[model samples]
Target chain A: MASKTQSKTTAEFADDPINASLTADDKIELLRKMVRIRRFEQTSLKHYHAGSIGGFLHLYIGQESVAVGSISLLGDHDHVITAYRDHGHALAVGMTMDECMAEVFGKKTGCSKGKGGSMHYFAPDKNYWGGHGIVGGQTPLGAGLAFGVKYLGQKGCCLCYLGDGAINQGAFHEALNLAALWDLPVIFIIENNGYSMGTSQVRSSAHPEEGLAARAQGYNMDWAQIDGVSVYEIRAGVNKAVLRAHEESRPTLLEIKTYRHKGHSVADANAEKYRTKEEIQEHMAEHDPIDFWKSTLIGEGVITEDDYKQINKEAGAEADAAAEFAIKSPFPDESEIFDDIYWEVDNNTEAGRTGRHFFHG
Target chain B: MPREITYREALREGLDEELAHDDNVVIIGEEVAEYNGAYKVTEGLWKKWGDKRVIDAPISEAGFIGMGIGASMLGIRPVMELMFYSFAYVAFDQMMNNAATCRYMSGGLINVPIVVRGPANGGTNVGATHSHTPENIFANMPGLKVVSPSDPYDVKGLIKSSIRDNDPVYFMESTVLYGMAGEVPSNDELDEGELIVPIGKAKVKREGADISLIAHGRAVVSSLAAADILAEKYNINAEVLDLRSIRPLDEQAIMETVRKTHRAVYVEENKPFCGIGAQVSSMIMEQAFDDLDAPVLRITSADAPAFYSPPIEKLQLPTPEEIVERSLTIC
Candidate 1:
């Protein structure tokens, strides 16, 4: 259950340090989340490179902790929905690696029964609504899902994730205003990678840093801006926003200033012509979420170097197994094109019949 | 025990009976509360149910309409009113994106049970922007269910049925016929106030043998008038079918009637080229080609704007005289 008491503010996230006496187990779990996301994306990136997967693939490489920390705060009853750049969030929300990879490969064993591909993954059992594609398209849908939560009297909130590029779309504004006016239980998180495709935030948006959160003011919503790369800070920022949403039946906006390690998609070369090599290297060294967590865990004696190798080895094995399973998994029957277009029956959905349960609830 | 009531009142009673019985149902739109709706279909609902149930909205069609989609996605039955049928364009994003695509796009995870109502079809001098019928525009979409009820009975029964349907329904009422009175049973009867006419079912107003006169929306009434004139004066028996729903058209009914009559005349209030009549005609020609004794005739308004000028408006919409003339030519 979410705490009714208001937590610390967005600025407070940067100020509050992890207690110096923190347990190794706690730090291990945090580091595990970071590793899980990193390994998953790396595997997916490898698959995309090998020409095994087709269609648009958006990897959440550097921004793994944003989803891990925020989703960790949510209960089983809570829901999540985001844009095409959604593998990290889906994995963090507990969708199996096999199904996620299968979906990317457009196999029968995939989530959405291979119909959704990368941009339209839906894990309803886990309360993950979708993997939408059209820039800001998922905002209104997220608001609707939150509205569903209120309508059914569910004691949970929906985390609506979008990109910095998505903020400029009209649906975002319409959804935010309506969510606040109705006081729907939703937390809107804008993952500001400082670019909407090739265009930088400065060129695309007039006030990029705070503009996303400021738009919430028209709806009188609680707003925050945070250093998104810092795992502890992102965790605190999301936890505070989630608390307000659960208790007050209100929506909050959080602007997470993060950077993407990979280029926009597998297509971009990330050539130094558009942006300096120094900037890319600066982000890799200074703001790499996984590196920061690994160092912190090691420094605190959370786990030995052996434990780190063991976890990475397990992740690699898991990714390899997932790839093997997806490759071996028969292509979905051509007849399956007609299936799952409209959901039928309550307990026996297609995803369940396939022995892949995205959500327990 | 039927009595006279306007199309608007019938719709109101239909909504009232639906909301009274179903706890999950609610109505939201501009002026649906204090101002009693622009067409007054939701009169006195706000004072009775309060703002929570009969929501009064700001002039944010895209916002509230999207809210309705969100509400429906969550399990609430929301009936949204697009102030004028013309203003429905403002919220097309919600209708097309969230309402129509949720089930297919979500890979069958969500069902959006939403009803958007307004007056469609031309006439009453609302001018070019406000007065053109665009139900055909939506009728072309694969996922949506489009309906245009032409009478008080249909307005009542169809609205009740649309409320309970799982798919998103686009219910277009008429501007000119909202005040047209007709027989509607009292609320005392068990099924009187609440009538569920299944979507995509055509109602045969009058069965005849000479020619099949098919129409919908305001044209249904116009076709019926033409049928009456043909029966009384020329003694030509023309079967008139009121096509209540447009998307999943009651093709079986139309094909059966065309098989009997061997000639067809489709009347529409919209312009001639590529209108709903064209689609209906194509379907008939494709399926019932051997049954046709003559070329299928279509009585539609001229291919021009629905201007404010009376004569131009008169030329740009189908009337009873035009339907009769077209039917006689087909006969």
Candidate 2:
């Protein structure tokens, strides 16, 4: 439960103010989301291994708290755009599990209507930008969304999530400077899972001493990184940043320091070569966000052992049902291929008067 | 109140009018404000509208261009200006993948009404890096609309319409024609939407029968000039067809022109390799094959980057002399 306020990853739940503020139902609901994300990702991983889904599949197992906590504080007007590690972000933005899973299965009923696979899922109506495939690609778009909020005179903010490697990108710095100069409402979230696919921060970044958080100082913006293993702590960190973004039209660089239990993607075969199995197991056993919340709930006597079991069972069934829906959904028809390419409104009555679209020479 | 104005002034008027017409419209780019734009196309609008509407952005094309796309989806119509068309490579991903595809990818749930306008031709001896006519590259995109206007009248009308369009429009301008004076109607002289040239329509700059000279942007000027030379010297009557919109390519107009002349000469400022002329040449071959009296000729830039030297650059792009010669050969 250690967070920005507590300033210690070693701190226990006694000093965690978020827990005292939230009700038992609230805490259980957060746990349910974390469990659902874990189950959904686990099921997706199993299917990828079984060859149900084609292309690279990036799981959000150990880093569930970042999406669960950060999304909880966002209003419906607030937007979210993240890298391909985005199943958790999609679900958190209120996309149905079936829709997200159907996209993974490349089905017609998918959120992106099967055009965008797992790495390119989008649900704009839900304010979720996309499941962008390119690393560090979503950084500029994040600032762009915030610039919209400012331009439209909307009292809202945008949360842009990217990996540790994204901060090194020139566009990232450019976006930060633009956001700060224009006073755009945006939060740049560096989800530092400590590796750029296979290479760790030690091998990737220039200023790895202070980690990704230190670079925000170069942009003259407020910055912080928190223990991403606790959803409560993650929420607390994002709460201040989001408030800062909306109230003052200030952009913040908030890094969620966590680890992914799986390889970078289903195709990352050499993950073990870069990291040891013992190191992986140790993070899973100790810093797992889902397990941490589960024990915290039980220790607080918020839920019984049976209740926890029931939650887990429900989460598993939901993930299984989502997969089943995706399996039953049909592939997009050939005619549908040319349908959404351009909106039909422009083809209708336009502003200009030349009805005939040609000049007879 | 029809009066002569420079193409740059006409374009600035269009942006200024659009900004006044709709609160959602804003001009965003480097030097678009305090510096009065890279080419002075947005000279006084920044002072007129202030920083709220006319914004001066960093030299980060990818960042601001992407931001413009995002802002447009949320109902802010962004007129993003790249210093040159070649700079589109910096924000190519956002321009192609995000802006162009957002409407389609979101199942028509989102609309990106952003106009990316800048000079696209290479006649200033700026070399290969600064001079690239990317009409073919952008027109190839499905969801994105590509517009290129020739005269001041067309530029004013199309730029306004491109800003108001409910789609991502890549408005390619000509640096060579920026200061070229042309007759443009005053706002009081024209009715609403009358001055606004619709996308995807071709204009008949001149009518003839011997050959058809088809082009867009600055090449349209050469095509007209070539038509005059062919008429005066060779006694070959050439019809000049200026394609205002590249994407919604007026195939009917092309067929009409080819059918009238029975010979077609496609000219463009872009390189010959996979240029707009190539597409038009094939379209005439496939669609209006029976009407053609001779093989369609394409007069485009040399299949290489622009030369730094003025003399070499002059030989690279399609010239009026070359177009006249190509037209004569085809006729």
Candidate 3:
């Protein structure tokens, strides 16, 4: 007997907060981050259509606020790992637009050196592990990070992001069970963007009504359900989880309800096949994260009409510059083929590249 | 000071020694804590290191394996043990896609210093579902380093090295050889630190001029036995080459053996089609073709699911008698 209003269960965690106070600067910055992500994705889609970008391209247009709000709450030392829809996540965690754009373009200066293409965007220096291509593949990796954090006595926690589609994977259950049993400092974030590829959560999951967060009680875990369209709510939910992780060494399952404005990927453009255009338009009008946040900022006197317009314009320009940088970047050299396979001693993967040249032998 | 030790004990000793040496090193798996490991390879580690160092994971291979990979990226060295390598099939995406590609795809920015060790060979009549020699499958991946040791001495030295190495190393052990004993170096005999065996290096267990018996894992022991028979009965000088590491491949060592013994006979417990032997034979024909006098012969398991029947299962694996017989043709 679960209700759609999110209060059917006693775990309406998004309503309250443990010190979710945000400064004016943090609010304005988060707003701009959302804008930057939306503009960057929009630009990538435009280029993908023009044949400038290749491969299965998934955009983080509708789900910008989730990544921005959640990551802003974590310290720079904390780690963030997510699924393939990660352009927004990478940007929110302070990845340079030029490097990310170059990565998607498969250029040499890309974060993954043009080898990982779009599905993998990793920056270990920034503590953003990478966006995994597999649906539930990165679940255990979060546990690993949390395990390391506890083992080394580091204060940093781990944030694991995944789509609603990944909830059904056994890795999710296994990871949650261990996370709870060990009381590790890891927060499992589920960005429920309505459909997993073409199938909605209702059709794919066994217990979809209670929200994926409801299953936390089974593992004796703490959980919250966030209205993902609201950046304020997203921030509140993550802030609470982070506090508990730091104080009690607890893991929480936070389900952020959101949607994808675009198709699953650039390849899946036929949105009309699954649902009506009216539903899409209605969601854009009512629940668009960017629009919702923009109105809040303007209403609260955070910015003027001119400021809002400028933010969008600047994000668009930044994305343009990134695209230019990526276009001009060179492809990797022929010698790069035999590198990064093994590490002999230190972090020198390119070692023995010349010595072990089997082609010469 | 070298002493006789079981492969199982030798593996446990490596885990114990590493746990004592590095605080970042942790052992994680099902039955590894209180259950003393499914095979008793980590019998006293949990008691020694306590719960924080030695952890027992849920029966979720994909989850814990991925967690191990994630932890390793953050400077934790996790030696994760699977009850059987067949269980790894559940976590293939994490093991192959994530663990193998993270370091290379990240432009060498991240390191996955995780050791996924388990019994990978088939001889226990555990049926098709439980038995899987997947070294070739893992070795095929570029960013991964595959290690399959033959004896207690090799297992003790190499498992320690696999733990120390800053890469994803798949350590393959055999259930049949776990109880078997071999001479291992004591602390006094070895360097001040643990014995470090280099990955991707093949060892010549026996010397010969007529033919080379190249193998890995349990097949190495069988090949050594086969070489003894070939020397005593057939009057053939058969060289036994133990390929401890599979991925970096040690192409130079393989070619050196091929040059020494012109005839080659490859033995593996994995299936024959597209197996490790196939790759070895292909490499020989490509690089060492000039030295080979005959076609590279392979004695692999029958290309089918491992049967539950003990006798049928025995026939499914590559045996010492079969290796000796196969070497006769190549010789």
User: Which is the leading candidate under DockQ?
Assistant: 3
Per-residue lDDT over B1-331 for candidate 2, one digit per residue giving the tens place of the 0 to 100 score: 4599999999998998899899989899989999999899999888889989988888889889988877776788999999998999998888888887766666556678889999999989898999988889988788888899999999999998888888788999998999999999887777764478788789999999889989999999998888888889999998999999887777789899899989998889888888888888887888889998899988988988889999998999888999987777766
Residues B136-196 of candidate 3: C-alpha lDDT, one tens digit per residue? 8987787787889999988988898788878888999999999999998887786665666
Per residue, candidate 2 scores C-alpha lDDT tens digits across A260-342 of 99988889998788999998988898778887878777877898889989999998999999999999999999767665665
Alpha-carbon error at B162 in model 2, in Å?
0.6
lDDT of 3 by residue, A158-263 (tens): 9999999999988888899989988889999999888889887778887636678888989999998888877767776798889888888999999998888888
* DockQ of candidate 2 compared with the true complex: 0.51
Error of 3 at B234 (Å): 2.1
Model 1, chain B: what is the TM-score?
0.96
The runs of at least 3 residues in candidate 1 whose Cα sits more than 4 Å from the true structure, single-residue gaps closed, are A1-27, A208-211, A268-273, A342-361, B187-194, B271-273
Q: What value does the TM-score of chain B take for model 3?
A: 0.98
Using Cα atoms, each model's DockQ against the true complex is 0.31, 0.51, 0.54
Candidate 2 lDDT (Cα, 0 to 1): 0.84
Q: Clashes in model 1: which pairs?
A: A119-A131, A125-A359, A126-A359, A148-B74
Q: Each candidate's fnat, in order?
A: 0.36, 0.45, 0.62
Over B104-124, each residue of candidate 1 has an lDDT whose tens digit, in order, gives: 655567777889998887878
> Residues A242-304, candidate 1, lDDT per residue (tens digit)?
777788889999898788877787777653556777887888877777776676567556777
